[model samples]
Target: MTGRIVRWGAVLGLGSVWWWAVLRLVLAPDAGALEGAVAAGGWGLSLLPVHCAPKSRAGARGVARWRHAWRSAATKASPRPRSDGGSGPS
Candidate 1:
């Protein structure tokens, strides 16, 4: 999932750069285009580098990092069927 997220993020980041060129230089150079470019770049492109960061990288350590830990934690907390005789969720 992280790989998928990072892939999407890369797509979005690249798209935003194209958007910047078309919006700022071609579409409307003086018609309040900065707001739209900023919006798309901020919400769509900014998160990409974080997800693409390596595990030991500083960007991957903060609270803003990916939520991969939650899955392992949840798995550990959940109960599983016993091999001897007990039955669990089916």
Candidate 2:
């Protein structure tokens, strides 16, 4: 859940940066070099997350194992069924 939130946040941030850059350039044709450089830097920084993601097959397997372990642990910690199948207190 947290991972999904972070990934979505990154996507939104990247979109915002690009949108701002485009609007600035379009609205002001006389934009300076610093502005252009900042926009370019924003684009490069936005791609860092993608570049940092795990690329190996082992990494994929590790993620799967982690998910499975988490699920199993959650299930194990849940309430169990009553042996007598009674709903009220004895």
Candidate 3:
């Protein structure tokens, strides 16, 4: 279905973006390289920012909380099971 395809596309797109961000954050010395690529492609600004150093201990806590929130949200959004009464009540 079209909706299924769109959902898969969004999942794959976001996954790729996250991978690219991590690659830029870890491998590239300057985040500007990633930024320049974005600019060349006509995006006004790059999403890759230099995050080599943690801003503060609170920042780490914030990241952990955000992760937990996303996990809980995903858990809540998941579909419930259906009772099929298998094998036609055999």
Candidate 1 lDDT over residue span 1-90, tens digit each: 999999999988877766675567555657466656665656675567654656576445555443567766777885765789766679
What's the ranking of the predictions by TM-score, best on top?
Answer: 2, 3, 1
Which ranking of candidates, highest lDDT first? 2, 1, 3
TM-score of each: 0.29, 0.40, 0.35
- The residue-by-residue lDDT of candidate 2 on 39-74, one tens digit each, is 888778767755455558436557778899999999
Model 1 alpha-carbon drift over 4 Å, by segment? 28-90
On TM-score, the leading prediction is 2
Error of 2 at 17 (Å): 1.2
Worst 10 residues of 2 by lDDT: 49-58
Model 3: residue 36 alpha-carbon error in angstroms? 15
Clashing pairs in 3: none
Report the C-alpha lDDT of model 3 over 17-66, residue by residue, as the tens digit: 65676667567887666644643443333445535566584355577888
